[model samples]
Target: MLSMLKRIIIGAPLKSTELGEQKLNKKKALAILSSDALSSVAYGPEQILLVLVTISAVAFWYSMPIAVGVLFLLTALILSYRQIIYAYPHGGGAYVVSKENLGENAGLVAGGSLLVDYILTVAVSVSAGTDAITSAFPGLHDHNVIIACLLVVFITILNLRGITESASILAYPVYLFVLALFILIGVGIYKIITGDVSSDLHAPIGTPVAGISLFLLLRAFASGSSALTGVEAISNAIPNFKEPGPRNAVRTLMAMGLLLAILFSGIVFLAYYFGIAPKHEETVVSQIAAETFGRNFMYYFIQGTTAMILVLAANTGYSAFPLLAFNLAKDKYIARMFTMRGDRLGYSNGIITLGVTSILLIIIFKGQTEQLIPLYAVGVFIPFTLSQTGMLVKWLREKPKGWAVKLAINLTGALISFLVMMMFFITKFSQVWAVLIFLPLIVLGFHQIKKHYVAVGDQLRLTTCEPIKPIEGNVIIVPVAGMTHVVENSLNYAKSLSADQIIAVYVSFERVDEKIFEDKWNKWQPDIRLVTLQSYYRSIIQPLTKFIDTVEKKASESNYRVTVLIPQFIPKKSWHNILHNQSSILIRTFLLYKRNVIVTTVPYHLKK
Candidate 1:
C-alpha cells in the first residue's frame, strides 16, 4: 500500500541513467540546499513578533536576545554539522548520523522528524511569503492561500524538472533578496544614527496585550528560532557536491550560517528600532520597510524582495526533502519510490509529493503564517536534538583525536536543542502537540512495515523438505485457447517434459465445430490427443476444475503423476488485461490443488 502511494505521489522510481544525466555541481548544489536557511531572513523576524504579541509591549524588545541566542545556537549547529558533512559526505543528513552512531530506531525517528520538518518548511515559507506580499498589497490578503498554493505548484514543477535548473533560477533571486535586505537595514540604521529617522509608523504604548511572562518569552524565542529551521539541509546534499564534497559543503554551510545570522539579526534590530509591534496580521519585514522608507519605491523594493525570498525559501525544502527521503528510502524506512531518480536524476517523485502536501497545508491553514509557526519548530527541533545526540555518541564511541573538544561541542548542542524542544512543547503544546503525536505514529508505522517485510521473508524460505525429482508416468494436460502462439508454446513445453501421454484440452462456451477442429489438427505438426469440455456459463475455473479432478482420479488409478501446462498471453501493457481471455490462473490454481499434479505456464509475450 505504501509502495502504491509512493508511486501515486512521486511518480515512478528513478533509474541510474536519469541520475547520471542530472548530477549537480558543488556551487549549484550548495545554493539549492541553502535556500531554506537564506530565505528565513524575510519572515524570521515576524515569527519573533508572533510569540511576543500575547505578552506586554516590552516583549517586542525580546527580539534582540532571541536573535542573539538563535545566532549563538546557529553557529554551534553549523560547526557541529560541518563535522557531519565531513564524516558522512554521502548525504545521510540526520538519519545517517543517528543510524551510524545512535541506532536504527534513532535513525527512523530522525527521518520522521526530518520529513515533517521539510513539509512544514514549505508551508511556512510560502505562507510567510504570501503574508509579506499581502502586506505590501493589501488587496492580495484575501487570496493568500490561493497564491501560496500556486507558488508551491510552480516550485514543485521546477524541482521535478531538475535540481540544477531550479538552483540556477533561484540563486539570482535569493542573492537579490539578500542584497535588497542588507541595503534596507543599512539605510534604515544610517537614518536612525543621523537623526534623520522619522516618527515610528508602528503602534505606541499598549500595542501588545499586557501580562507578559516567561512562557511568552520562551514562545518568542522558539518562534524566532524558526529561522534556523533549514540549517541541516546542506548536510543532506553534501554528496551532490563536487570532489572534496564535504570540504566544500562545510564551507558553504558556514557561509550560509554567517550570512543568515547577519541578515536575520539585522532585520530584527531594524524592526525593533522602528518600533514595529507584534501584530497577528502584520509581518515585521513589511512593517519595518513601511516605517523606514514610508511606502516609497525603496520600501516597495524591500517588500518585493522579502516576498521573493520567502517564496524562494521554500526551494530549500525542495532540495533537502528529496535527499532526506532518498536516504530514508535507502534505509527502507520510506517507500522505495523515493529512492528512484527521475529522468533529470533528481528525486522528482519526492519533490512533487512534498509540494502537494505543503499546498494542502497552505489551503487548510488558510495561509496564516502565525498559525503555522507553532507546528514549524517542533519537527525541526526533534531532528536537531537527535542529530546532536548522535554526534555526542559518535564522539564517545570513536574517541577520535581531540575527542574531548568534539564531545563538549556535541554535548552542548544536544543539551541546548533538547531544552528548546522541551520549552517549545511546554509553551506551544496546544498548537504543536499534534505534530509531536503524529510523528511518532509515523515512526511506529515504519517499524511495523519493516517487521512485516522481515516476517514475509522468513516465511518464504525454501526448506530442505522440498526436493526436486522427475515424475514417473508423466501425463501432460495442455489447456489452450484457439490455436495461437500460446498453444504452440504449450505443445513445445509438453514435449520437453517427456510426458508418457499428452492431451491438448480446450474449453468451449458451446458445441465445438468439427471443421474448426479439423483445421487446427491440420496445422499441428506434433501429434497429440485432443479433448474438449463445455461450460454453459463460459466460466473457465469451474470447467477446468472438473477436468482436473477427472484427470487426477484417472492418474490415481494408473499410479501416474499429471503435469498441466496452461498457455497464457503475457500482458505487455497495463490496459491489455481488459480484453476478454480465458483465465489461465484459474486452471493452474485448480491443478495445483490435486495431488500428483504439477502446473507449468507456457507464456507468449504480447507486443505492447
Candidate 2:
C-alpha cells in the first residue's frame, strides 16, 4: 500500500531514455524559478498595513516611509545577491556563501534561516491572499483556513505534475497581475499628485488605532520588511538560468528588484494618500480598493488579482526549498533523497513537502493573515543579515582592486540588516518566537545526522588480518531444507569458502510431504553427500539441534571442525509472510548452543 501511494505521488519509474525527454529549457526554468519573488507584490503592501494598524490611525500613512525603507533594502539585497550569483553560480545561495567564507556553522545558520523563511513565505502569502479574496467576497471571510488549504493542495498537485508544467500555467497570470499592479499604482500615483484623487476615501468599515509609540514604529518597519523576503530567491535560482547563467541571473535580479521597489512603494503611497488606514479587521489593500473602485467591478478586480498573485507567491518557496535541500544533501547535511531530481527535472519531493507544510500552517493559524504576519519577518531577515555578512567576509578575503569600496558597502548592509533582524526578534519574540523554535531545532537535528554519518564511516573501515589455516579432517555441516533457490545458492557459496570440507544436510518436520521432499532434493543433485534427519513431533528446531549435536560429537572425537550453512528467504513484501514460513534463524540459534559448528545464511530475494 505504501509502495502504491509512492507510485501515485511520484509516478512509475521512468526508463533511462524517458529522462532526457522531460528536461526543462531556459524559459520554462525561469518561469518555475522566478515565480516566488514575482508573486510577493500581492501581499507585501497588506503585510505593512497589518503592522501599522496596531499603533495609531495615522500609522498607515507611514506605509510610504516603510515602503521606501523596504525599497532601499531590496536594492542593496539585489546588488549583494548579484555578487553571490557571480561567486557561487552553482546554486547554493546562502549556504554556499557562508560555507566558503565564514565556515560550516555559519553556512548551517544561513541554510536554516533560508529554509524557515521559505516556509513562512508560503504560509504568509497564501493566507494574505485568502484574506484579500475574503475581503472582496464576504461569504468567504469565514472559511479562510479551508480555502487556503485547498489552494495549497491545488498548488501541490500542480507542482507534482512537474516544474515546467506548473511554471507554464502560472507564469502568464503572474505577469498579468504584475502588469496590472504597475498600471493601478502608476495611475493612482498620478491621481494623487494631481489632486484629482478624493481625500474622503478611507479604509472601509474598520476603525484605526488612535495612539502610537516608538515600539509601534519599529514593528511597522519589521512588518514592511516582508516585501524583502523573496529578494534572495533569484540568487538561489542562478544555476537554473540559461548559459552565462550568472549574468542572466543578475539581470533578472536587478529587474525584479526595480519592479518590486516601484510597485511596493507606489501602492503604499497611494494607500496612505487616500486615507486607507490599516485596521485589524480588514486589509489595507481591500479597504483602499473598496473605497477607490467602490464595491463594484474595480474593487473585485483588485481583490481577484491579489488572490492570484498570493497563490502564485508560494511558487517562490517551491523553487527555493528544493535547491536548499539539494545543497544540504550534497554536503551530507540532509538525506540523499533531496539530491536526486524527479522525472521532470524538478525536486518533486521537496516541492510537495513545502506545499504540505504550508497547508498545515494555514490550518493551524486558521489562515488569518494577521496571525501569521508576526511569524513571517524574522526568518527572512536572519538569513538576509547572515548572507550579507558572508559577502563582507568574502570581499575581505579576496582583497580585490575595489576591496575597500565593496567592503564598506557590504559592512553597512550587514549592519543595517542585522539591526533590523534584532528588532524583529525583540519586538515580536513573544508573539511569534515559540512557533519558530523549530527552526534552530531543525539545524541541530541535521548537525547530529552528519555526526552519525561520520561515526558510521569511521566504524566501517577495513584492516589487514592473517589468513586462515585449513585443519585436517574438518567437516562443515551446512543444514538445508531442500534444493530450493536459497539452498542451492547457499551450497554454491559454501564451496567457494576456504573450508577443509563441506557437507549438505536437510531436517524435516513430521508434517512434511515425502514426495515434495524427494522432488526438492532431486533438483539440486548435490555434488557433496546429502543427509536428512526426521522429527516425530513436527518440531524442526529441536530435531536439527539434536542431529547437529551428534555430528559435532563425532567431529570433536576425530579432532575435526563442523560448519553449518543455513538457507533463508528474506521476506520482501508485507503479504509474503502469509504464504510461506522458514525456521532458519531458530535452527541457527540451536546450532550456536552446540560448540564448534559455524552457521551462515544464503538469502533469496522475494518479489515486493
Candidate 3:
C-alpha cells in the first residue's frame, strides 16, 4: 500500500537510463531554476521597508536609496556568476572553483556554506509564499506554518517525478507572476507620468536626508539584498540546462537578472511613490498591487500568482541542493547515500532531507520570514566571496584570454561580496550567531565523513591480500531445544557442511524436562552427538554463548571453521511474530562482529 501511494505521489520512479541528457530550454529552465531570484522581489523590497519603518513612517522614504544599494550588489553578483557559469560549466559553483584553486579546506567551507544556504532558501521561500497567501486570504493568517510545510511536501513530491516533469508543471505560475508584475509596473508608471493616481494611497512621508544615519541605511541595504540570493544558482546548475548548457545557462542568468532588477527596482519605486508602508496585514508587493490595480480582478490575480511563484521558487533549492550533495558524495565528503539517485534519477535521499529540514525550520520559526531572514545572507554570502576569490586566483594563474579583464571583475566582486558579508554579520549578527556555529560544524562533519570513507576504502582494498583458499574443514554446531522437524532439518543441513563432527547442543534453564526427549532422541538413532548445558540462573543465552566461545578458541588452533546452525519458526501471518521467541536473531547479532565465526538459521513454517 505504501509502495502504491509512493507511485502515485512521485509518478513511479523512472529508470536511471531514462534520466539521460534531456534538457530544459530557456522557458522551462527559467521556471525551475530562476524562481528563487525572481520570487525574492516579493520580500526583498519589503524587508528594506520593514527595517526603515522601525524609526517612523518618516524614515520610509529611505527605502529607495537602500534599494538602489542592493541593486548595485545585484548587478555585481550577476556579472560575477556569469563568469562562474562560463568557467565552471560542470556546476560545482563555489565548491568546485574554490577546491581547484584555493584547496580542499576552502572547498569544504564553500560546500558547507552552500549546504546551509540552499536549505535556508527553501525555508525562507516557503514561509514568504505562505505570508503572501495569507495576505490575500486573511482567513489563513493563523495557519501559515502548516500551509508552508504542506507546500514543501507538495513541492518535494513534484520534484521526485524528475527535473523535467517539475519544470513543466511549475513554469506556468512563474511566467504568469512575471507577467502580472510587469503589467502592474507598466500601469503604475503610466499613472505617475500622466497624472493618474490612486485616491486610496495615504499621503507620502518626507524624512529628510539629515534625519537618517548611514548605519541605518546600510542595514536596510543588507536586509533588501536578499534579492540577490538566487543569482548564483544558475552558475551552480549548468548541468540541468539544455544543449550548450553553459551558453543556455548564461542566457537564463541574464534573463533572470534583468527580471529581478526591473521588478525589485520597479516595486520599490512604486511603493515609495505611492507612500506604501509595510503593513502587518499584507505585503509591500501586495500593497503595491492594491495601489496599482485597486482590488479588482488583476489585483487578486496578481496576489494569487505571487503566492504561487513564491512557493514554486523553492524548486530552485530543490534542484540545486541534491545536485550539490551528489557532488559532495562523489568527492567522499558526505555519505554515499546522497549519490544514490532514485527511480526518477533524482537524489531521493537529499530531496527528502531537504523537505524535512525546511518543514522543521518553518515549525520552529512559526513561518516567520522576518526571523529567518537574519539567518539568511550569512550562508548566502560566504560562497559568493569564496567563489570570486577562487576565480581571481584562477585568472591570474592560467592567464587565459582576457584574463586581465576577468581578474579585475573577480577582484572587485570578491571585495564587494566580502564587504556585504561583513555588513550582514555586523548588522544582523545577533540573529546570525547560529550560522557562525552552524557552518563550522558542517565543515567538521564533511571532514569526519571523509575520514570514514577513507578508512572504509583502506579496509576494503584487495590489492595486498592473498587469494581465496578452500574452506579446509568445517565443524557445524546445531543448537537444539529438543528433537523436532525444525531441529531435524537443521541437523541434516549442518551434516552436509561438516567434514567431521556434528554436535547438537541443548541449553536447559530448568523449565523443560529433557530426559524423555533424550530417550526418544537415542531411540531415533541419529549419528550427531548431543551435548546438554545447564544454567541455574535460568539463562539460556549466557551458557550457549560461553560454549560457542570455547569452540571458537579450540578451532583457532586447527584448520577448521566453526559454524552454529539454529532452527527458526516462520509465522504464517506477520502479526504471529509476537507469539514466537527470537533466539536466532540474538545469536546472529553476537556472531556478526566476530572474525571467522558463522551463524546460519533454517526456518520451518508454522501451520497455525
Candidate 4:
C-alpha cells in the first residue's frame, strides 16, 4: 500500500535514459523557476506600505521613490545574472562563482546563505499565500499556519515527482496570476483616468511616531526587496533545462525580470494612486482591487489567482535547494545522499528536507509573513553581493573578449546590492544578527565534511596488492541445529563451493538435547562431519560466534578464506514467520561483522 502511494505520487522509478524526456524548455522553465519572484508582488509592495503607513504622511508618500530604487536594483541584478548564465553554463550560480573567484571559504558562505534563503522562501511564500486566502475568506485566519503547512506539503509532493511535471501543473496558475494582475492594473488605470476615483478611498491622516526619518524609509525599501530574493534560482538550476540549458535559463530569467518589473510598478503605483494604505486586516493588493473594482467578481478573481501563485511560489525554492544540495554534495561538502536522484529524476532527499524545514519554520513563526520577513533578505542579498562581486573579479582577472562590458555590469550590481544589504544590516540588525554566527558555523561544517571524506579516502586506499595472506585455502562453516531437510539443503549447497573444510557446528545447552540430535545425525549419516559443543549459558550465537572467531584466526594464519552458511525458512505468509524460533538469523547477524568472514543466508522453501 505504501509503495503504491509512493508510485502514484512520485511516479514509478524512472530509467536513466528517460532523463532527457524530463528536461524543461525555456517557456516552461520560466513559469516553474520564476514563481517566487512573480508571486512576491502579492506582498512585496504591501510590505513597503506596512512600514510606511506607521510613520507620517510624508513617509507614506516616499513609497514611489523607494519602489523606483528597488526597480533599479532589480534591473542591475537581472543583467548580472544573465552574464552569470553565459559564463558558468553548468548552473554555477553564486556559490560556484564565489568559490572559483574568491576562495572555498567564500563559496561556503554563499552556499550557507542560499540554504537559509531557500528555506525562508518556502516559509515566507507559503505564509504570504495563506495570508492572501484569509484576506478573502476571513474565517481562515485562525488556521493560517495549518493551511500554510499543507501548501508546503503539497508543493513538496509535486517537486518530488519531477520538474517537468511540476512545471506543466503550475504554469497555468502563474499565467493566470499574471493575467489577473495586468487586468487589475489596466482596469485601475482606466478608472483613475476617467475620474471615477474609488468611492472608498480613505487615506488616513498619519499621527507621526518618530516623524519623517530617512532611516525608516530605507527600512521600507529593504523590506520590499524580498521580491528579488528568487532571481538567482534560475542560474542555480540551469542544468535542469533542455538542450542549450544556459541559453534557455537566461531567457527564463529575463522574462521573469520583465514580468516582476511590470507587476511591481503596477502594484506600487495602484496602491499609492488608489489611496490603499496598509491595513492590519487586509492586504494592500486586495484593497487596491476592491477600491478599483468595488468588491466585484474581478476583485475575488485577483485574490484567488494571487492566493494560488503565492502558495505555489514555493516551487522555486524546492527546485533551487535540492540542486544546490546536489552541488554541495558533489563537492563533498554535504552528505552524498543529497546527490542521489529520486524516481522522478529530482533530488528527492533535498526536496523532502526543504519541506520539513519549511514546515518547522511555519509552525515556529505561526505562519505570519511579517514575523518571517525580518529573516528573509539577509540570506538573499549576501549571495547577491557575492555572485556579483565574483563575476566582477572573474571579468577583471580573466579579461576575456567583451570582459569590459561584463565587469561594469557586475560591479554596479555588487555595489548596489552591498549598499542595500547594509541598509538591512543596520536597520534590521537585531532581526538578522543570528545569521552572522550561523553562517560561519555552516562554513566550518563544510570544511569538516570535506575533511571527513578525505580521511575516509586515505584509510581505504589500496596499500598492498599482495594476496590477503600466505595461505589460499577457502573454508565454509555451516551452523546447524539438528538433522533436518533444512540442514540437508545447506550442506548440499556447501558441498558445491568446496568440500575441503565445510564444518557443521552444533551448539547444545543440555546433554539430553545434544544426545538426541547426535543420534538423529548419526542415523541420517549426512556426508559432512558434525562438530558439537556445549554451552552452560544457554546461548547459541555466542558459542558459535566464538568458534567462528577461532577458525578465522587459523584461516588468517594459513591465508585461507572463511564462509558461514545459514539456512532460513520461507513462510508462505508473513505471520507464519512468528511460528518458528530463529537462531540462524541471530548467528548471521553477529558473524557478518568479523573481518574476512563471509555470511550467506540460503533460504529453504516450504511448499506448505
Clashing pairs in 4: 471-558, 471-559
Report the Cα lDDT for residue 417, model 2: 84
Question: Distance (Å) between predicted and true CA of 584, model 1?
Answer: 9.7
For candidate 4, give the lDDT.
Answer: 0.86
TM-score for each model: 0.77, 0.74, 0.90, 0.86
The per-prediction CA RMSD against the true structure, in angstroms, equals 6.2, 6.9, 3.2, 3.9
Instruction: Compute the lDDT for candidate 2.
Output: 0.73
Model 2 lDDT tens row, 168-218 = 888776777766677677667777778888766643333454676667766
Q: How do the candidates rank by TM-score, highest first? A: 3, 4, 1, 2
- Ordered by lDDT, highest first, the candidates read 4, 3, 1, 2
lDDT of 3 by residue, 479-525 (tens): 88776788888877776763577888887766456566666777774
- Candidate 1, residues 1-608, lDDT tens digits: the string is 66586455545545665554455565566567777887877667887876776664456777777888888889888888988887788988888899888898888888888888889889988887888788767898899899999999888877876776687788777777878888888988898899786545334444554587777777777777878888998888876776677877888898888889888889988887777775656667777777777879888887787788778888888888888888877766667799876756787789889998998888887887566666777788888899989988888888999989888877877887887888888887888878767877988988887777666666667764545454448788887677777788889888887789898877777665635764666678447887777778977778777887788788877667877888888888756677755578767766676766788888889886
For model 4, the stretches where C-alpha displacement exceeds 4 angstroms are 1-6, 12-15, 134-146, 198-210, 360-370, 458-471, 474-491, 499-554, 570-593, 604-608
Reference-based lDDT, each prediction: 0.79, 0.73, 0.84, 0.86
Question: Ten-residue segment with the worst summed lDDT in candidate 4?
Answer: 199-208
**Which residue pairs show backbone clashes in model 2?**
36-316, 478-565
After superposition, the stretches of candidate 2 with alpha carbons farther than 4 Å from their true spots are: 1-31, 130-150, 190-196, 200-212, 279-281, 363-370, 435-439, 459-608
**Pairs clashing within candidate 1:** 10-349, 14-340, 14-341
**Candidate with maximal lDDT:** 4
